[model samples]
Target: MINRYGPYKRYKQVFGVTSHSNPDKEHTVVITDKGEWQCSCPAWIFHTPRKPCKHIQEAMKDQVVQAFTPKPITPKVEKVLNRFAAIEV
Candidate 1:
């Protein structure tokens, strides 16, 4: 059920983030087909590289998003989580 949402793992993920300027307004953050995080907010619309808007930053920290999206794609690397075989110490 890794793709319960659809064939694509992260293409349909979305989150509603409340704007800091106006709590009444909520922003829409989504995952692109290429696994990039995007936000429907003014700050993100007008920014350079390495400058993710507050909404995008906040959404990425969420547990739900964490489950779907892995930390920004790093090439040729893996994190160890568990040991499956016995090894001599």
Candidate 2:
């Protein structure tokens, strides 16, 4: 099974991501403040030094998509400048 941890906001400017195969296991990937990625999984620690693990790849994909997606623009309501002008009293 797979689990996703975050597109979590860190400090102010940095974003973090973590994921694992199961909730009981250690984090598979952690994207740090300096934009460096770390994975605690055995494959990362032993085999893949120059390449990112699957968890890191997934998280980075999410972050990249989110960054480019446009935010919804809310329409502004115009208020009457002279609401009392038409009042008889």
What tens digits encode model 1's per-residue C-alpha lDDT throughout 1-89?
11112122334454556777787666656665667666666676556653678887777676254345333321211110011011101
- TM-score of predicted structure 1: 0.55
Residue 85 error for model 2, in Å? Answer: 69
Clash count in backbone of candidate 1: 0
Consecutive 10-residue window with the lowest summed lDDT within model 1: 76-85
Candidate whose lDDT is highest: 1
- Listed per candidate, the RMSD to the true structure in angstroms reads 15.4, 19.9
Candidate 2 minimal-lDDT segment of 10 residues: 75-84
Per-residue C-alpha lDDT of model 2 across residues 1-89, encoded as one tens digit per residue: 32333333321111223334455543334454556665554565566334687755665666555434322221210011122123212
Those runs of model 1 whose alpha carbons end farther than 4 Å from true positions after fitting are 1-10, 64-89
Reference-based lDDT, residue 77, model 2: 7
Using TM-score, give the best candidate's number.
Answer: 1
For model 2, the local distance difference test gives 0.40
